[model samples]
Structure formats: structure tokens, C-alpha cells
Target: MKKKPTITAQTKQNLIDAFWELYCAKRIEKITIKEITTRAGYNRSTFYEYFTDVYDVLEQMENTLISKLKELPMQQLSSPGDPFPFEALVSMYSHHSKYLVVLLGDHGDPAFQGKVKASMKPMIKEILVSQGAKDGFELDYTLEYALSAMIGILSYWFNQEKGPSIENLMELITELSSEGVMRKLIG
Candidate 1:
């Protein structure tokens, strides 16, 4: 679908950027749309044009993140495989670690996390199918199961003060899944 040129996109993006800046200097609960628009140099209507509230903006941010991560060709990924993309993703996350920490902090919505999980199901199924797991192999059930597992691991990595390096984590996931159940369908 071709996106028509409009102020909505710009306003939404500006709001998101504003939220990021404010989120750094203040807590998410303390922030307001007034502050977001002011920081973003937009007006109230512009802010309304984008998101309903601070949490709404946060939802948009999470969706953006999931989409970004989803862009990665993550199916069939294994140890001793490509390093560049995984490294790039980790680097990006590390760069924005503060943003993520604040947005997904203790008070964040479980439903927001659920949205991310729901969103990634199709992508996970794609990876599974490409790796020789049938496209319809228990479909939604397996997709959700695998995606939930991946999300759980990623959340642990994201929350920790120190954890396995991305390279290590990538290899870890591959080893855990690839050789055990994942190899069964292919062989």
C-alpha cells in the first residue's frame, strides 16, 4: 500500500521522537502529551493526530521495534552463521537500551508485550516453514509457542545488567533449537 504524503506521518514521528527525549529526562508516568508536543515543536492537534496518549505513543514505539526486529531474516538462523545483521540489531538495541528500559519498565503494559508477540507470530511461522517445518504445522499454536520463547529470552537479555553477548545469544538460541526439535523436520 502506497502511503499518501501527509502530515500525520510527520506528526507521529515527531511525537515519538519527543517521547524519547522526554522519556530520558523523566519517567514515563510523569510525561504528558503537552510535554511531548512542546518538545517535538508540534501543536496539540498534531499530537492528537498521532497518538491518543503517552502509552499510545509507547505502543507505537514497541510496534516500531517489533517491526524492526521482524525485518531480520531470523528463521533457520544457526551458530557459525551470519554475524553482521545480528550484530547490527544488538548494536541498535544497545544504543537505545535506555529507551527500551524506560518504555518497557515495571509499570509498562503486559498487553503491549502481547501485541509484540501477536505481531511476530506470522514471521516466526515463516521462519519455521522455510526451515522445513510445514507451513501449517500446528500453525498458530507453534508460532505462538516459539515466538513466546524467543521473546522471553530476549526480554531476559534486555533486562539484565549483563548477559550473554548478542553473538553468544544468537548461537545459544540456534544450538538450543536447531539441533534438537528443529532438525527433526528437515532430516
Candidate 2:
């Protein structure tokens, strides 16, 4: 008999959560399907139905995150005089901190960081232009720096045992974005 969509989705999430728990503790190569199935309380056959292997689970999770990131209200930032949506951005990131902290960590996939930067490029460019940034090498370098800094800060925040409040995090991002790091540090 066909299963309810909710059940199917929950089952998949359970497997993913189980895999994620193992993934957080050790390298992906060392995590076995048996471990995931056992943690998820599912048979091996159930895992195969949702994912081909451990790597597939990671791929799906990354795709889901990237898709959600793309869905953020980026277009709103294109309008002139509109403040950067720091609150929205932080809210989204905080919501997914569990996955992001790991995916962007030392033990995580290095290439995933690039995927995230790529997804945010267009919005970043729009924000730059709106802020009077000229289009050229400077823009390119600034974009690269901003993306790197964002990822680094996010990784740092999420990895902390007792990180700053979301409001404080948002304020920090705003300050860094508006005032150059050197200026913020010097003053």
C-alpha cells in the first residue's frame, strides 16, 4: 500500500537526521549505512528507498539548504534605499544552524562553501551596486571578500557553545558590512 506523504517525508528526515548525527561526529567515509539505519530505527531496505548511499543523503541535504537560501527575499534588496535584510538573513541561517555549522566546518565539504557563495552572488552584486559600488575588479574582489567573511563569521557563530544572541549577531554583521573591518577595529 502507498504511504502517506507526511510519513514518507518524516521517514526520509529521520534517516537524514540519523546520518547527520553520525556525520557530525566523524568523516563521511567512516559512516556506514548500518550505523545510519540502526540510529534511525529503520531497515536497510528503507534507506535504499530514500537514498542510494551516505553521499546521497549529504547531497540531498545540501540541495535542500541551497534551495532554501535561494528562496530568501533577495529581490527586495535590489530596490534603492532599502536596508539590507539582515534580520531575514540571520533568521534563515539561525533556523538551519544545525546543518550549516557542520556543512561549513572543517570536517564538512569544502566545496559546499563555494556553492553557498555562488547562490548569494546575484544578491550581493545588487546590494553593491545600490550602494554605489562600481562594476569592475574592485567589485569582484569585494564580493569575494564579503562572501568569505560571511561564511567565516557564520561558521564561527554556529560553532560556539554559547554564541551571541541573534540580534547581536545581526548587529555585528551590519557593523562589519557598513564599516570596514579596519575602521571598526580602530574605532
Candidate 3:
């Protein structure tokens, strides 16, 4: 009798790590399953046992990140007079900066960013409404602006070698977010 393929969490993580490494080194189109398995120290059968293709692996990675972000204490930021929950936010990104840098790099996936925005918008909207933003065009504009600026700042931080300290980054986010860019510009 033939043995069934046993997929373990370790093996899946190895594959993900290996895939990220290869993806960092080259474009996704240039990466092959053979390379992924070889780097992961697994064979073809083992690689296929968990993921159907490279895109599937990428999607899984993106979903895993999204899930982590969703689990953060977003409700804490909703209250009035609360300090900006910067530590929690920055730590989560810095901890996973390796995979994130790759995704936000020159060869990054725009689709992944889109998915991230979609997943995060609702939480941000709730936070804003709780902080007294009215449900109107202003709310929509604020959501759009906040999400875009966040993605841009994160991408910059991940890519730069001497980016601001996490605390500084948090301060920058808080200041700019509270003080509108136009206000700073017009001053």
C-alpha cells in the first residue's frame, strides 16, 4: 500500500520561509517549485502535498499576515483620550518585517496591498466612528486617507535602512494623522 503524505506545521513553515527567501532574491515569475522545495529541503511530492502552486503559497502568506493583523487589539484605539497604541502596531510589523519588506519591495504584490486595505478598513472605520467621526463623506475620506498613508509609511519604513525608530515612527504617524497634511502645508 502507498503511504499518504503527512503535512506538518513545521513543513508548512519551512516552505513559507523558503518561498520568502527565494521571492526576496528574485521576481515571483522566475521562481520555480523545484527551487522552493530545494531551498526548503523538501521534495516535489512534499511541496505539492501542502500547496498547489507558487501563487497559492503567496496567497497563504498574505492571508496569514492579514489574520495576524486582525487579531490585534484594535478596539483599544477606539476610546477617547486613549494614547496611540503605537507599540502594539509597530511591534507586529517589525516582527514580521522580513516577509513584509519583500511584499512591499520593488517586486511587491499590489494585490496583497489591496487585500490588506480591504481587511483593515472596517476596523479603522469603527475606530474613527467611536472617536466621534460622523458617517458621511468626511468619514469615507478620512478612512481612505488614513489607510493610504499607513501603507505608504509602512512600505517606506520596511525598505529604508535608517528609517525612524519605532517610537519616532509612532509619533510621526500620530502627529501627521491628527494634524492634517494640508494644515502643515498651509502654515
Candidate 4:
């Protein structure tokens, strides 16, 4: 996204480091490009050379963080069932809670959230299909409800920094799925 050659490894690292420090301490709105540059020891022009805004910096931070967080599939997730997905999502959030709270704080943009949800949706569909779910279940309300619940739990847990452990979360997910998620679509 950088149009200028002014971007450098050191500059990128400085900006990320500055953003992380600010995000961890408080909400994203309280932080500013000026503060980031000040902390990173870079000026306005230097900051512009890399990211467009504080939000952009956070966006990139999140993109990078999610990629890193998703690297561990099983260790990072509860079972794939809807009810317990939150636990797995929450554990990953806990792994990167500071980054997430700031990235998704009140000041966070909705488009980024959409991007995140879009990425996860197909995976859910795939899980459903693989489990012998009929085509009807792919867009069924139960799936949607389950997804929303999981996302909600993830948001709450990340923001509050409180919730069940990953193991418990997985158990909950399996229990919820057994209730209906594993049922035949043809039935």
C-alpha cells in the first residue's frame, strides 16, 4: 500500500511497535498518528510514508496478527460446532487480546470486521458440509445463529478478558453441535 520508497524495514517496525504500545494501554481513539510518530521517533512525513492513518496501522497490525494467530489450527480452536466456536476464537483472542481490543475498539471500522467475518464464514460452511450437512444447512438460520453467537462471545471475551478456558470452550461446542449440528440435512 505504500506508494513511496520512504518505507523501510526500520520504519515499519517502529510504527508497529508504537501502535502496539498505545493500543495495549488504552482505546484506539485515544491514540493518534502524532503520538505514534512521537513514540517511534519518526516525524509526520515518515509516518505517512508507511501507513495512511492510525486506523490503517491498526488494520495492518490485525492482518498480520491474525495470520500469526491462525497458524496453530487445533491448538487455536474449540470444536468447529457453532455453540463452542467462541471458546476457540476467544483463546486465540486471548493469545492476542491486546492487539484485538485496540483493533476492534469503539473507534474500529466496520469494513475490517466484515473482512474478518467473510474470511471465517466459508470455513464454517466447509465444516458443515464435511460433517455430512445437506446443502440446505449451508445457509440455514441455525448456522447463522451459531456463527453470530460465537462471534459475540469472542467479542465479549476479548473486550472483558474473561471467559472459559479453551478446553471447556471446545467441550461446550461439541455439546451444542451434538444437539443439532450433526443432524442429517435430509431429515
Candidate 5:
């Protein structure tokens, strides 16, 4: 007999959730399979059934997030004269704030952010190129700056206990991206 997909997914999620709780409190190096299994109310063997080790759990979580991000209608947002899709961006961040807040935080893996930026680079480059950005160093720098700024803003916002509302966050990013920070600050 085969196990139901829902049950398997739920089991995996329980393990991931347990690992995430511990991950948020300390570095991954400090986490252990024993602890995760204990917290998840499962035996050691069951943890192995779903994950080879602690790091696997984190990797799976990152992969899931990136995969979901790739599913967004990013191409539509790249059309000329269309504002950057701040609403979609904000909604995605808000929906995943719980995981992202920690994944991009002090205790999280530094390489995760690099992975995220790499995944986003192509679409962002497409958008920039559509807006008349030329290839080479300028485009490279602009891509890095844009990805860094957006991630930085999200990290800061999600870390806040009472972060701005979604609409406000989207508006703030729009103004800063469109008008430039210096203009927003000076005027």
C-alpha cells in the first residue's frame, strides 16, 4: 500500500517546521537531528525517512521558496511602461514572512540570500533591459543594487514586529524605486 501524498507532505512539513523553530533561535551548526525529532514529536528514524540530515531540511525549504517564486507572472511585469510589480513582490514577501524573516536574518544561512539573488537576476535583468539598460558593468551593478535593495528592505520590514501594512510597504518601495531615495529624503 502507498501512503497518501497529503500525509507525506504533512509529515515533511512538521519536520521542517520543527527544524525552523530551532533554526530561528540559533545557527544551523548548533541544531541537531535529535532536537528536531524531539521537537517534532517523531522518532530519529522518521526524521531520516524524510531528511538525510538537518541541513537537508533547510535546503528543501529554500528550494521550495525559490520554486514558488519562479511560478509568478514575472514576464508580464517586464512590459514597457508597467511599474515594477510591487504588489506581487510585497504579497510574496508577506506570505512567506515567517520563513524569510529568519532565513534572511542574523541566524540564517548567508548563502541563501545569494541563491535568491541568483534566481531573481535573470528576470530582473530582463526588466532593466526593457527599460533601456545596456549590457555590461552598468547593468550588472544595477541588477546587484536593485536585488540587494529589495532584499534589504524586505529583511528590515519582516524583522519588524509591527512592520508597515502591505499597501504601505508596496507604496514605499514604489516611491523609493521610482523617485530615488535622495529625492524622497530631500523633498
Candidate 6:
């Protein structure tokens, strides 16, 4: 029989879940380790064994999200008409709605937000470059514009109590990316 690992998987998940619950209610700086452990029903020793501090918990969470995003088939998202990739993105974000609201909202970590944008930059560039090639326009400015707009939109959507449905948000993004402001303004 395999030796049982200490700090079992469920325990780690519970710690993360508890930390998220508390972090959502108040800023990370305002939260205490005691509170986290209390909520998680774990003692300080156990918490210490797994993490260095509240920030470590946040870092762990960020790493998990980054890993998930890295696993996405970004190269497969060749066009705006590709609903599969958009669906996956929206679903992944929606699955972590509460955590996203806390992490991407007003009191969120600026560094983490920057990391999120940086991680997506390459994939965004790839998609936009492909689209721009067909549209016959300079994409340098457009790529930055699209990325900033997306972050703003995502921040807004996550903050809402009952935001637009995932499908609705995805549709709006697809429409905006496909039509663009210049075309809409010209028409």
C-alpha cells in the first residue's frame, strides 16, 4: 500500500477555499492567518506547514490559474469565428467568478493583474495578427487597444453581482473584435 501523504490534497483545497472565502470579504492585507485557519478548521501549524503567509496563499492561487490558462489550446484559436476557445475562456473565468471578482476588482493585486495580462499577451497577439493580416491594417496599435479594452471589460464583468451571462459576454466580445470601432464609426 502507498504511504499516505501528509497535507492530503483535500486539506490543501480546503485551505485555498477558506482563504478565498475570507479574501473575498476583505482585502488580503486586512485578513489574518488566524481567520483563515479558523475558517478552514485548521491550526496555525498546519497553515504554516503549507504556506509562508497570506501572500503565499494568493501566490499559490495565482500559480494554479496560470497553469490552467497555459493548458489552453491558444494556437487553435485561429479566428474570431472560433467559438470553442472563447467558450473555454469564458467558462474558466466564470467557474472562478468570486475569486476573479476579488482578484481583479478595485482592491485586487496590481502585480497579479499585470501578470495575467502579460501571460495572455502572446495568445492575444497571435489571434489579432491573424485577423489584422486579412483586414489590411496596422495592428500594433490595435493589439494594445484590444488588450486594454479586454482587461477593462473583464474587470467590470467580474465586479458585477449578476453580470451578463457567459454566452452573452462572449458574443459581445466576438462582435467587438470582429467589427471594431473604426468600422462601426464609419458605418
Compute each candidate's TM-score over C-alphas. 0.63, 0.83, 0.85, 0.66, 0.86, 0.77
lDDT (tens digit, per residue) of candidate 4 on 1-187: 7544455877798888998888777677899988999999989998997799888887887687657544535323434333234545665777776656655556555455555555565565566566556657445655556655555556665566467766776677666556665453213
Please list the C-alpha lDDT of all candidates, in the order they appear. 0.65, 0.81, 0.76, 0.64, 0.78, 0.71
* Candidate 6 ranges beyond 4 A from true positions: 1-3, 80-85, 127-141, 161-165, 181-187
Candidate 2 on 37-60: residue-level lDDT in tens? 999999999999999999999999
Which regions of candidate 5 deviate over 4 angstroms? Answer: 78-83, 180-187
- Model 2 stretches with alpha carbons more than 4 Å out: 77-84, 130-132, 162-165, 181-187
Which 10-residue span in candidate 1 carries the lowest summed lDDT? 76-85
lDDT of each residue in 123-157, candidate 1, tens digit only? 65555555566655565555566555655666678
Q: How big is the RMSD of model 3? A: 3.9
lDDT-superior candidate, 4 or 5: 5
Query: Positional deviation of 115 in candidate 6, in angstroms?
Result: 1.3
Cα deviation of 28 in candidate 1 (Å)? Answer: 5.5
- The predicted structure with the larger lDDT, 1 or 2, is 2
RMSD of each: 5.5, 3.9, 3.9, 5.1, 3.8, 4.4
**Candidate 5 overall Cα lDDT vs. reference?**
0.78
Query: What C-alpha lDDT does candidate 1 achieve relative to the native structure?
Result: 0.65
Model 6 lDDT per residue over 5-95, tens place: 7646778788888998888778888988899899999999888978999999999998888777767777675445441256666666778
Residue-level lDDT for 20 in candidate 1: 85
Candidate 5 displacement at residue 49 in angstroms: 1.9
- The per-candidate count of clashes, in order, stands at 0, 0, 0, 1, 0, 0
> 64, model 5: CA deviation in Å?
0.6
Best by TM-score: 5
- Candidate 1, TM-score vs. the true structure? 0.63
Q: Which portions of model 4 show Cα errors greater than 4 Å?
A: 1-7, 23-30, 66-91, 104-112, 136-141, 158-162, 180-187
Predictions ranked by lDDT, top down? 2, 5, 3, 6, 1, 4
Give the clashing pairs for model 2: none
